[model samples]
Target chain A: MSGLLDVEGLVTRFYTEEGVVKAVDGNSFRLEEDEALGVVGESGSGKTVTALSIMRLIEAPGRIEAGRILFRGEDLLKKSEREMRRIRGKDLSMVFQDSLSSLNPTLTVGAQIARVLKHHTRLSRRARWRRAVELLAAVGIPEPAKRASHYPHQLSGGMRQRALIAMAISCNPKLLILDEPTTALDVTIEAQIFELIGELKEEFGMGVFLITHDLSVVASFCSRVIIMYAGKIVEEAGVHELYAHPLHPYTRGLLRSIPPLEGGEARLQSIPGEVPDLINLPPGCNFSPRCALADERCWQVEPELSGITPGHRAACWRAERPAMAGGGHD
Target chain B: MIVFLSKRLLLAIPTLLVASFLIFSLVHIAPGDPIQVMLGDFQDPELIARLRHEMGLDLPLLQQYFHWLGNIVRGDLGISITVQRGASVTDLILQRFAVTVELAFFSLIIALLIAIPTGIISALRQNKLSDHLSRIIALLGVSIPNFFLGILLILFVGVYLRKPWGAGGYVPLSRGLLKNLAHMFLPAVALGTAYAAIIMRMMRSAMLDAMSQDFVRTARAMGIAPADIVRRDIVKNALIPVVTVIGNSIGYLLGGSIVTETVFRLPGMGNLVIMGVFRRDFPVIQAVVLIIVVVRIAVNLIVDLTYGFLDPRIRYGGER
Candidate 1:
C-alpha cells in the first residue's frame, strides 16, 4: 500500500534544566492511506511527542533534531511556518486529549469551529456557521444548532470531546492524529468516540494515527500497531498477529498485562520495572534492563528491528526462537 | 438580568449607608476641631462653644451622626466648614468631582493604551530582547512613584524645554479639547504609569497562561494565523483576570489621583479633600470619602456584570 505518512529516524529532544531528554529517539513508522495506525506506550514513552513532531508543534527547549516527515510523498520539514499553517487543519489535523482544556473557554463551540472554516475555506459567515452546526450534528451532538452556541464549560464531557472532534474534522483533513482522545472520557463515552472516529475516517477516507496507552483500544481500532519503549519502537505487526505472537519482550509484557475480561483467573500481570529515564537511558537497548530474557549480548549491543515473519518485525534478539503463546486474545 | 441588577442595586444601599457612617466617624475622630480651625485666634470660649453647637458637634456622637444621616437622606451634604465657608458640601463636591472623574477616565485610557499592547507583545516574544526591554520599562514604571515622575516631567518637558503644555495647571475641556488633553497629559501619564506597569505584568502572565492553554494549540493546529489566535483566543481569555485586577485597582487609582492632582495643581476631588484635611473642613472630607466609596462600589458591580458578559459560563440571574 502507498504510505500516506512516513516518519523516518525521527529524533525529538528536550533540553530541560535537568538534562537533554531524548523524548522520541529515532522513531520510524508509516501510515497508509485509509489505514488506522496505533502507537502504544506508557506516560513518558514519547507517543505524544511523535504526534507533535509531525505537526511541528514542539515548543522552546524542545526541538526535532533529525527526521524526514513525508506526508503523501511530500517532505513536511521543508515547509515554512506560514506554509505549515495553511497545511494544518486542511491536510493535517489533531484531536488532543482533555476536551475541557482543548476547547477554547470563552468562545462558543460554534464560533470555534467556524474559526477553523474561516481560515481554510471561502465560505461566508452564515455558511461557515451552518457548516459548524452540520459538523456538530455529524459528530452526534443533540440539537446541533442550540449546542453550538454553548461554551465549553456548559457542555458535558462527552459533548465537549465530540465538539473537538467536529472541529478537527471541519475541513475534511487527509490525516487526523488523535492523542489519547478518550483518556478523560468514561468507558461508555470512550466507545462512542471510537465508533464516531471510525465512521468519520470511513466517510472522509482519511488516515488516522491513534496514540494511546490502552492496548485494548489499539486492538479494537488500529489495524497495524507499533509498541514503543523509552522512545523506541520495539515491535510492529498487524494487531491480531502481534496479539497472538508478540515478538519483542516489551510487547509480550504489555500483552500479558492486559487483564482478561472473561471467565479466567483474575491475577493481574504487570511489567516488572518502571520505564527508564529518557535523559539517561541504559546503553545497548533502552529496554534491556527490564527485559526478562536479555542476555550478555543483549546488554552489550542493541538489536535492530528485523523481520520475524512475513509482515511482523521485532527488535529483540530472541524473535527467531519459537514464540510462547499464552497471551493470545480469548 | 433584571433580577441580578435589582439585587445589586439593593445591596448598594446598605453598603453606602455603612460607608457614610464609617466616613463620618473616622473624620470626626481625627485630631482636629473644625470650629477651632474656623475661629482661628478667637479667645472667646462662649463663641467657640456656640460655633460647636451651631455645627451640631456639641450633641452626643450618635445624635450628631443620625442628624447628619437624616440630612444626607434629604440630599443635603451640609455646608463646607472652612475650605469654602457656607458653600454647600454637595455643590462643592459636584464641582470638583467632575475634574477627578475626568482625570481618572483619561488616566485609565492611557493605562489601557500602554498596557494592552505592551503586555501582548511581551508575552508573544517572551524571553526575547523586546520582552526584556519591556520588563525593564515595567520595572522602572513600578519603582518611580507618580508624584516624582510628575515633577520630573515638569522639570524636563515644562521648564527645560520651555513648552507651555508641559507646565502644571488645569485647562477645562470647555475651552479646547486639544489644550485640555495637553494640560492633562502629563498628570495622566504620571498617574497611569504605575497602573500600566501593574496591568502589563498581569497581562504578560495571563497571556503566557492563555498561550499555553490547549485552545491556543488547537487554534494553531487549525491553520489559524498567529495574529488571529492571539487576537481571538489569547487576549480575550487572558483579559478575564486582567479585568479583575483593573476593577480592584480603581480604589487605588482614586487614592493615587489625590496625590497626582495635588502635584499637578488640578482642582479635582483630591485637591478638595487635601485642602479640607489641612483646614479641618469636616463636611468636604466626609462628602468626598463617601462619594469615593459609592463610586468604588458601583465600579465593582460593573466589573461583576462584565465578568458575566466575558465568560458565558458565569450566568447572572439564573439564566443558563
Candidate 2:
C-alpha cells in the first residue's frame, strides 16, 4: 500500500570549513498511516538530519541537496517556504529532544501552543487559549490551567516534555516526527512520555516517525524498523521479523548489544569501529570498515537495498547467505 | 515583589551613605583651597584665615566631613563656598538639573532608536554586506569622542550648512517642545553615537545568540512567520542582556553628558560641576558628585528590576 509519507532518495549535506559532510546520503523510507516507523541509528547516522530535512528546518551551513518528501502524495520539496510553513505544524508537526530548551522560555507554555494555533487555525485568541489548556490536560498534565500560565522552567522535566507533546499535537497533525524525544528524561519519565505520545497518536490517528538510538525503545514501541549506518539506511523490516530473522550485520550487532533480561551472564556484544567520517567516506559500502562480513566484493562495490524476502530489504552483500546472516557472531 | 523592592531600596541607604562619606573626604582632600580660589590674585593671609574660619574649613577634616554629612542628613546641602557667598547649593543644582536630565533623556532615546534596528539588521544579515557595513559604522562611532563628534556636527551642520538648529545651544522644553528638541538633536546624536555603537554590537551578538537557541528553531518549526519569530522570540530573548547594556549606558550617558554639555555650552549639571571644579565651590562640587552617585545607583536598581520583567526565570523574591 502507498504510505502516508514517502521520503525518496533524500540527500542532506553540511558545507563546513573542513569539507562537505554528506549527513544524509540518498536515504529513502516511508511511514504508513497510523503506523510508527522507528529510525534507529548512532548519533551521526543522519537520523535527526533526515527528520530535520523532512521538516525543512535545516539552518545555515547545512542544506537539503536533493530530496522528494511526499506527504499525502504532494511533493514537499516543490513547495515554497510559505507553503511549507502552512504544511508544517498543521499537516505535520515535530517534537524535539530537549523539551525545556525546545520551548520558548520567554513565553508561557499555553501562549507558545496558542501561537501555533493562531497561525494555522482561525480560532479567536480566547478560544485558542482554551484549546491550549485542553491540549495540556489531554497530555495528562495536572492543574492544566495553572500550568498553562507557567514558563517552561517552572515545570519539571517530564511536565515540560508533556507540554512539548501538547504543543506538537495542538493542531491534531496528520504526521508527528519525534527526534530523540526521551533522550533527556529519566527512564520512567521517558516511558511515560512515550506512552503519552502513543495515546496521542491513537487519539489523533497520526503517523509517527520516531528517530532514536535506543534499540529497546524501538523494539517495544515501533511496528516497523529502519536501521541506519553512517548516512544510509542499511535495513528495513517489520520490527518482529527484523528481530527474529535479522539480515543486516549492523542490525544483528544492534540486537546483540541489547542486554537480555533474566540473563545467564551473556556479554553484551558491540559493533567494532566507528561511524565513518561523512566528508571522507570510504569507497563502496559505508559500513564495510565496521562490518565483520566485509569481503573484497563488499569493499569494492556497494550493495543496493535488494529484497532478501517479502517485506524485508537489506543493503549488505551477504544478506542472501543465511550461514553468515542469522546472528553471525565471532 | 514588595519584599524585593523594599530590600533593594533599603540596600541603597548604606550605598548612598558610603558614597556620601567618600565624596565628602575626597572633596576635602582635593587641592586648591576654596578661600584661595574665591579671592583669586587678591592674596591676604589674615583675610583668608578669617574666611576659612567662618566657613568652618579650619576644623579637622573628619569633623568637617561629619558636619557636612549631618547637614546633608538633615536635608541641608550647605551653601556654595565660592559662588554668590551663601547661595544654597540645592537651589543652584535644582536650577541646572533639568537641563542634564533633558539632555540624558534625549540622548538615550536617540541611542535606542539608532541601535535597535541596526543591530537587528546586522545580526539577521550576518556575514553579508549589511553586516560588514554596520560593523564599520559601529567601529567609527565608538572610536570618535562625543566632543569631537559634537565639533564635527557643529562644523558641518552649523558652520558649513548654516542650519539655525545645528549650532551648540539650549532651549528649555517649556519654551516649545519641538524647538527645544531641534536644538538638542545634534548634541543628543553626538552624545549617543558611542552608546548606540556599544548597544548595537551588544544587540547584534545577543540576537545572533538568541537565533541559535532551540526555541527559535521550535518557533520556526511551529510555522510562525519568520518576521514574527524574530519579533516575538528572537528579539524578546535577545533584549534580556541588551537591556542590561542599555541600562548601564544610561550611567555612561550621565557622565558623557558632562563633556557634551561643556562642548555645547548647556547649563546642565556637567556644566555646573565643571564650573564648581574650576572655582573650587566645595559645597556645589560635593553635592553634585553625590547626586550623580545616587542617580547611578538608582539607574542600576532600575536595571535589576527590569531583569525580572524581561526574563520570567528571574522573578524577584519568589515565583508569581
Weakest lDDT window of 10 consecutive positions for candidate 1 chain A: A321-330
Which pairs of residues clash in candidate 2, taking residues 3 or more apart in a chain or in different chains?
Answer: none
Superposed model 1: Cα runs more than 4 Å off: A323-330
- Which residue pairs clash within candidate 1? none
DockQ of the candidate models in sequence:
0.83, 0.77
- By DockQ, the best candidate is 1
Residue-level error in angstroms, candidate 2, position A148: 1.4
In terms of docking quality, model 1 is: high
- Residue-level lDDT of model 2, residues A67-138, one tens digit each, is 798999988889899999998888889999999899999999999999999999999999999999999999
- TM-score, chain B, model 1, is 0.97
Q: What do the candidate models score in CA lDDT, each in turn?
A: 0.92, 0.91
Chain A fold similarity by TM-score, each prediction: 0.96, 0.96
Error of 2 at A302 (Å): 2.4
- Those runs of model 2 whose alpha carbons end farther than 4 Å from true positions after fitting are A323-330
Model 1, A1-330: lDDT tens per residue? 449999999999999999999999987888999999999988999999999999989987999999899998988888899999998988999999999999988999999999999999999999999999999999999999999999999899999999999999999999999999999999999999999999999999999999999999999999999998888888999999898878888888888888888965877779988999999988788888988888888888888877888779888886654455454455
> How many angstroms is residue B293 displaced in model 2 relative to the true structure, after the best TM-score fit?
1.1
